[model samples]
Target chain A: MDSSKVKVVTCIAPVNIAVIKYWGKSDENLIIPINDSLSGTLSMDFMCAKTTIIASPELQENTFWLNGKEQSFNNKRLTNCLQEVKRLASKSLPHLNWKFSIKSENNFPTAAGLASSAAGYACLVSALAKLYEIEDNVSFIARMGSGSACRSMYGGWVLWCKGSSPDGRDSIAKQIAPASHWPEMRVLILVVNDERKKYSSTDAMKRSVETSELLKYRANQIVPKMTKACIEAIQKKDFEIFAEITMKESNSIHAICQDTYPPCVYLNDTSHTVANAVHAYNEFKSSNKVAYTYDAGPNAVLYLLDSSVDEFMSVINYLFPPQDTAEYYKGLPLSSNQLSQDLKMALNIPVQEPGCLKYIIHTKIGEGPKILTDPQQHLL
Target chain B: MDSSKVKVVTCIAPVNIAVIKYWGKSDENLIIPINDSLSGTLSMDFMCAKTTIIASPELQENTFWLNGKEQSFNNKRLTNCLQEVKRLASKSLPHLNWKFSIKSENNFPTAAGLASSAAGYACLVSALAKLYEIEDNVSFIARMGSGSACRSMYGGWVLWCKGSSPDGRDSIAKQIAPASHWPEMRVLILVVNDERKKYSSTDAMKRSVETSELLKYRANQIVPKMTKACIEAIQKKDFEIFAEITMKESNSIHAICQDTYPPCVYLNDTSHTVANAVHAYNEFKSSNKVAYTYDAGPNAVLYLLDSSVDEFMSVINYLFPPQDTAEYYKGLPLSSNQLSQDLKMALNIPVQEPGCLKYIIHTKIGEGPKILTDPQQHLL
Candidate 1:
């Protein structure tokens, strides 16, 4: 990548959730996953990130900004992504001359489990691709940002190739089916707050690769099987297989995390509370209509059918009702004072007075990208 | 239960090496192994142990004898095994009033990965069963001694039940199809000389249980499927699947050991050198007729067909020669030392200047138990 010489390029992108889940990587530097992974891109309306890049003589080095605050972009892993994207863009736009500056921000919580970087990088690459108009296209550029980000260049159900190509050019993401293919597939974003990361995904993955034979097995057996099921579920619009695969793969990943030395401390009590409730609800009904997956944070992303919205919300409402409902919900959603008073009382989590969940949005599935002409919008 | 009983019975039994390996334990304390681990009971002709139990009113305290020398049996785990066996015998025959003096010795090294204890315990239980004519049966008696010892009672080919029963009474070892059933199965043991164990099998297994998700996957997925194949292969005289499963499971066990924190080291260079040769031979050939499995020690037991003895021997014959092989065969035997001077010079191993391997015992599979009661022997 030419360190000097750049103009203005901007992009907007949406987050993605792994449907099959990618727990282990084969090549750390190359970011080649052990097996093919399937993911669902979030809608532009709810979760998105915007990124802009500028070139000038002032910058002695590349600088990064998130939500207008200067942030370190010196991390080799992140820098690798930037350098690759720049490499591709500069190859074609050879005469371009200027130092580069990057500004990006996630609309949602920065440190949250939601894949803000997937969106952030997707937007960054798309903007550069547009500015450079290089032959490699958005996906070719997106692949440099993050393996999953390539999928964000497309809308709806996207499949990232667990590509065998050494260069990773062919490992770019492509749409399996459009978002409209299963728009009724809804995700109830469960927000569980936590602090910053203790282990970066790269470091954690490396640890797992070195120390976990279970990871090797997953890479060889479980993930491949799950990826197939996920793709088939999307294509056939089969929510049953979709839900089963999603839930199992998530559990498998969390299990791998737990299998690590000194283990990953990603989840919290609230997350477990939400998970247990969902599990209870599903097990009681004897149906696989809903499934939940969580990421590096405590928050969960619950995939439910359009038909189960009322029942799901009822469970949530029972757990976290308005402040005035305390008298009726005696045995549930106990406060700290009440919990101390009654040990037998079960926890409903978040112990909300009101609006205690951070926030809950009931949203349906949608496409990956959207163009917001008005740049100064309501975002982080 | 009586710690003050001077009539303590001590037995030093040899451990059995599985021709068909056992990997997972269904019940921990009961030593109920998941699959039937098959093995041969090497003759007391080459190596055997002598144990005598004397119970009298004159004795004062309970003690143990290892290799004819008095030793402390205060170690909880060892004491527990002895106590349990004694309790079972005493419970069965309350009328036998005798204070027992116990003495034990092994003609060969004990617990150096030849499964000396498994053999010794089984033999101990056998002798005890004979002494009291305990109607509870020798299998039951052996189970009380050690989990694997139960299998040691009749050693042609045995299956240690991964007993589902909670009390574990049903977990006694059973004769699958004795060595007589498959006389064509040949075992060439390659013992490697690494005096110190990096970790005991007990510790390694516990580590695997706690730290290894790989073990769970193997136990849950691989073993179950492999076990069925093994039983079928044995019944149908199918050598291919039998060999493949044995080697894979052994390798998987070793892999789990390597994945342990501070890792459990198993194979030394000598061990790997033999393994590499075997692997290369198998890979180079159009058909793989031979397979190898190792126990806690570096000893590699090569299982092959009777017809392939010459080829197998030729390939590994260099490891054991035509002379007094037993003297050259140190506690841990490396194959390269048995090679001709020319071949030994070409190879880098524990290859000394002269013949070093124990004379190869070329034998076919045979029956388990024989009762020879000559009048003179019986009187003695």
Candidate 2:
């Protein structure tokens, strides 16, 4: 290895939305969750975090930049991820002593309350692992950065096992099915307009672990059955069962948030409206065509099938009419579709004033992190 | 009694806000709840449902009038309550064959989302019990009218015991403590301005009973402990524990609502703001000074001590400013208090735009149903 040489790797990671939510921790230090969680890896082409890492012996120290802003290297999780990658590389790579510069950016709005951190960290670990030539699974290392990041380390349907071991070696995410297995599965992300300062997910989860009794019951009694049902539904291509489980799990997690002392409220009026509208649409169609899941924010990520997307988009447009119809939808293109009067009458929900949602993103099941072999795609 | 003579009885019942809510029913037909519930009865001077019953042999059939609008007597709950009261009277009085005319009205806004049915059913049962001279507890009959109405049948703090018997014979509201038990306890009912069509509590409860798995866990595991803690807190005059339990139980009930299939959303954005404001105030005080509870609507019922009322009112006025400051407050008079910059800075929540709440009703714990000797108070 030449002392003057530089090694760089660029990768993009998909954002995974949990169908069975992961909340609380058995080992806070190891970032081990209390219950198994399942998620769908959303297409990186629509919304993702792109990370690039450059390593050179001439560099003074490890430095990180997120979007356009420089961040502190003193962050414990960031430090842990770096150290873990270097420790894994030290066994075989002689270039592990080089200092690194990292640049990360999200294609979508970071402030929109999407799980940008999960994608960002997963991309970071994947890039670092590639730079060091570590072929083994690095999801556990990603979990140290952010617990949910582990789930984003896989493509298509992924399940993060809540292992009993104290060291958390067995708690890595595993891909249940590849994206090709469920090509018809689609996702619509509804970004709600909210101005309130959000309660940090880390703090909220900690408080819930300490205070919420319902959370314990949820983890112990509810999630295992849900995880099994969700896996079976995914495998069998049962959209109805899959949608029901997804919606119920989302509701259960938010319920635990509310049950937390001082209560962490994530779902705003818009979130509730979106959820209700989905149920109304399903009822009108006489089947579960759409399912909504909310994280620690007001934005809703809806799951549906390819066949239902056009009608559901029409329904969404009718219920939450945009202030400016142009540029209200992003990502995958949707064809012009009209809502029927009979369906509208059947829905019966009042049409919201213009722009309840800032915008909607149309995407689908996709592969995990991909290396950018073309140098032009690199950030640094 | 003479055939042409009219025997009239008039009574009023207080509105009760459940601290530990009753959601699911174990026996639907019998109105037997799955778990015990506790409530605080508000003073009737501020809000009450008044009912007058007139029985005469000359009447042709049973007729019922609510708020000047004639309603059908075909309502099953209404029929059950009337039949039960008459059966008890039949053992003693020969005039039980007489047809009746019943009239009921609420002093407050009927559509304001206050538990009018609870107060209405309790008032009707109380009035009929008085007219029939049935001195035994009629809370079970009130329960038949509406499951929560039984809690309204008692004054101060009342507990509706979830009895073991399938007949629900032992299930009755028992006074935990009289109004004089804690003279310093005060209530501030903030009526929110919501335009969405409200979910009927009856339908919501039935759906929760059938669908929400969390409801079962809450009823079987959580409520009993909370009920015990609340009872102890009230007995010991421990406002902190009492307030915590009140808020937690409210959150728990709402959580169960969210967990229900198709979901029932009662709390809107304004409701969430009020809750956060209450929490901010308590955190500012470095003590549990106030607690809030929401029923199956957007209205927030806050519980606090008398000493905390003035400052908390200032906080409320600052957080949710009224459009017209004149009629914003009703019932008990509040001393004018100003919010300080220090408290405002400490709260750190955005001051809501004017008219988030329609009005605030200042009240205190009060006695149960009372018979009025004055025939002038009768609606008939």
Candidate 3:
């Protein structure tokens, strides 16, 4: 085995925003929710995690940098993720023995509720799998880090099994549809300011563990039904069904967050602006077809048909002139009139009498995660 | 039965903010939610809708004014409420007859979560009941206008019933605990900037009408349990239980809103701020428990115990410091260190600092709807 040669493995995974949200976790230890949720993965280059793992003798300790912040290497979750990847990697490359250093960051914003970590860890696991040529399943590895990270393993539509497996070994994300299955679908990512959340995902989950009971009911009744709906929607390429499920599931997850005693963290107004903007655009769009879903943060990941691109762009330009619009729109609900009123006053980046998404991508359906061997380049 | 020597009787009702939320519609047409929701009649100095009911034999039309804009008099729901009130009034005053004219205005700094109309109609019924000297209970008349607004008929801690009646006739607002019941209880009304809601309460109700199965589930499962919890909390004057129920119910209603097919509106950062502010206060003042709940709009109605007012004040002053602390706490999620970072960059307002709430009220509790025979001056 050529395992002794310096080994560097990198993995990439996309984020998934629950349409049927997983807001409250009943069992924090296992990351078991009280409800079953439905979510859709965004088909964009921006919303994902890219990770690099190096097993080297020179590095004396297991250390890391996340999004460039040299964070405490002691986080149990990160440790768990690293351990899982190494164990799997070791199975295939047993001769490689050394200290490991992993660096991870999200292409998308982290923890405003969109599931960056899910994608981040998923990619982390997958990337290591690729780097070491591990035979262990990717979902199995990602699950050890975060519950929903496993869902990030697939591209189009994925489902996380709230499997009854006591240790959560069987609970993993399964792809319901491949990205090639729906080539016409489009997702518009609105990075609502990259503010770090008040309560980290872990803290909020811990709160839900103690307070919410509806969460328990949700995990049981609603989630099961949502999973089935997700399968049926993507199979038929039914946007209406997919969108409806996506929105409802996310809402439900947010609801659980709201209901979780002492309350859980959620996306703010600017985040809400994304929801309203998407809603207005969908209403006014010719197909009335766009769908929106959010992760833990306020950023909105909207999916639409290609025909509505121009209209989506026009509406976004009108609603969010990009700078202060994100500020004004953050504290208020998006009204059709507010767009015009906002345009009248916004001079920072040109009236943006017609605005633009920070950057718009004309992406079609997508495949699962892919490694980027180069820097300063879009995925080819 | 000379309905009045004067041709018309004019009246207005202040919109009540739910310190404890009334969420989930048990009877959609009736606007009844599952729990026995609780609220404060706010200081009413500013947040009020004025309505005048004029009777004239020569009048040829009926009209309604919302913030000076004329609305079509023919909406079915409005008609249902008006007719219901008149029917009740006529039963008491058999010969009182004249074409009725109504004018209304909301002194709200923000658009009502559309709770204004609920208050207006409830007040319309209340004022008319007094003017016409109706024999039927005000509760009965209030119900005709808006099921929940009926609770506003009386000040202090009010409750609206989500009873099991097919015709929705039994659903009425009742006083479980008055403001006077707990003289030390205080409500801090955090008025987020007033912008019209993206979805009107009317449109939201329609969405709930068409797509919300969870609305039904809530009414059947969650609300009933919560209603009982609310009653017990009020009876015992237990702030912890009261706060728990208030917040839970609010989230439940919001959850149903999420379940709506097209989805619905929500609070932004400022709203999130009010919530996080209360939470931060709770964290600092573990003994001086203050809890908050939001209705349909972004306005935060927080419940504070008389015993812990000072701690709440200090926390409010600190988290939302009079000038920039070391954070940005104002926009949303007041509990986060990032907010602290933002607060560091911005000016923070202390509680002792002027202009925190639109205006703080020192009143303890007040009685149900009352008429001012001498209208020289009135806060209500």
Candidate 4:
């Protein structure tokens, strides 16, 4: 190990929103999901987590910091991820016995059901892989941090295969399509709420696995069909099929959540308004134009095509009518225009006082983790 | 056929809250349910619909009125109910060619997910049965108007059996116990929102039957077990088993509602808050003290025992502090007192401004439809 020289690696990873949600865990320690799931890796430029890792022999102990606040690294999940990645370090760097200092931050709010952990863990795994010169499947290590993190290992469309193997070695996330392959794919992150979830996804998922029979049924019977349909729809570039399946899967997951003992309620009034608006928009056109998906919070992540972005955004703005005009919208630039009167009548959503939605982020499909060649971008 | 004589029949029917929900129809035209359902009739003194019918030769045609507004009697369901009941009339009333004028009014808001139709139709059927001297099962005629109406025909805990016969004659509601059998059972009707549901229960159930695969599975597999458990719990006066099954069944119905394509969402944020409050109340007590069931609207109908009513009401008042003090509460008389600080902290509900709940209705298990007895109570 080089005590005189510090080896630092900085990388960025984009967030991934599940179309086929991963809810229950077959094994908690290894973070093995009960069902195979699919997701779209969102554009890194619009939303992501950036992390910098410095491995120095002079460091007192391994330490982690998030958004400039020192956090404990003693968590078993983090330790497992660190151990798995360290085991894969190159034999050539046998002297790499340096304690690591990791710093990470997200562009979006943490724990707001925006998959902050997924991007954070993925970025950490990507930087560690680069530092140790180990490239063979970093997803397995990322899965140890958070189950959904495995999907963030690749860009564009990804699938987390819930393998049958007892050892969980076969459970890995694979890229279904590259970001370049789906250039027309667009996303609108509707921040209906910014507060942290009352129940963390981890705690909620544990409760669902323990008490919800519906969760078991959904994992065993429903998800496999949805996974195949989603993959086929992506391959065929059938937005209609994709939109239908995405909305249904999101609902199925939420249904299972509500079925849990003591029930996990995530969707709020604003969330319902957005969902109804989407459905009404599709019904008015007599075709699917957009789909809405929610995680363990009230924020709505809408998936649509580039062509329908303008009209759908208008519908969203008209229905939600943000209170803080400055913070009303954040995504891709949408030009001001009159929303169709007919569409408003069809949706029948009351024009909420401005700020029903905190803001909206415009983005598209993005690539997997990448290194920062510019040293100035490093956090530590 | 006489033109000068005026005959009036006045009756009152109590609203029935389902423990094992009835969601889909095996035969839409015949109104044969896909699953058997169980419910407890709320006391008429607390919540009910009072209907007065006048059969006279002076009326031009059959006309109906709800809440003092004249309503059309052209609906096929109502027509079917009228025809079925008319056919059961005794030969003694063969000279009864008199036109019918019916007026119905509810103590609670109509179409606010309060099972207003159940009580309305049950009252109409009960009045007609008395007026026409029909001794046979009037529940079948009530079922023609609404499947749940049949359950309202019986007092105390009632079960609407989904009979296997080709003809629906076997599909009748039967009483499990009289209201006096379990006099301690109490209900608190919290009007979280008085707004009408976007989709009526009839329309939603029809859509669920047509589109939801989960509904089929729930009806065929899940409901049978729940129905059996509910019956056992009611017979044994086991509030714990009854509460668990009631909450689970409500969640299950809402789950299937979400699973339906272009989903039907009935519960709102306030509804969810009330549910969470019930759960937290039970958790703090280390046992089930209350169970909440939401039908097709945001309003919550809570089932608990007489002993727990005071503490639970205190918790409710602390969480949903009245918006307009006048409309704040309606149910059983809750005495003013300071809520326990520990219980409030445990609930963690943000003290809502006054009027989060329109009002609370206090009541308990009530008897089936009955004649008003007093001639002055007659509307005709």
Docking class of 2: high
Docking band of candidate 4: medium
Q: Which stretch of 10 consecutive residues in model 2 chain A shows the poorest summed lDDT?
A: A86-95
Flag the better candidate by DockQ, 2 or 4. 2
lDDT of 1 by residue, B1-380 (tens): 34454333333333455655555566566566655555555444445454555455565665657676776766544555555556666555643555455566666666446666666567666655545555564564466455567766764666665666776667676667766678777666655555432456776666667755566676666666666777777778788877776666566566555444323546544454456456545654545577777776567777778676555555565543435545533322233423245434333334222232333433444443332333232211
lDDT of 1 at B127: 54
TM-score, every prediction:
0.51, 0.97, 0.77, 0.95
Model 3 alpha-carbon miss at residue A355, Å: 11
lDDT, candidates in the order shown: 0.61, 0.91, 0.61, 0.87
Top of the candidates by TM-score: 2
lDDT digits (tens) for residues A1-380 of candidate 4: 46457888899998999999999888999999999999999988878899999888778888899988999977998989888877888767943687889999998877556888999999999999998999698797899898999999999999999998876777899999888887999999888763423787888999999988777778888899989999999988999999999999988888888888888988888888889889989999999999999998888999999899989888987887767778666757767567888887888767666666877888899999989979899998
Query: Quick one: best lDDT, which candidate?
Result: 2
In the range A230-285, model 1's lDDT, one tens digit per residue, is 88888998887788778667666655664453245365545655665666566656
Predicted candidate 2 versus true structure: per-residue lDDT over A1-380, tens digit per residue: 36358898999998999999999998888899999999999999889999998898888888899999999998889988888888778565756887889999999888888999999999999999999998888998899999999999999999999888888888899999998999999999999999998899999999999999888989999999999999999999999999999999999899889888888999998898899889988888888999999999999999999899999888888888788768787989887588999889987888898877998899999999999999899998
Q: Which of candidates 2 and 4 is the stronger one according to TM-score?
A: 2
TM-score of chain A of 2: 0.97
Could you give candidate 3's per-residue lDDT for residues B127-178 as a string of tens digits?
A: 6676576756566456656656777787777776656676666677767777
Best by DockQ: 2
- Name the better of 1 and 2 by DockQ: 2
Two-way TM-score contest, 2 vs 3, winner: 2
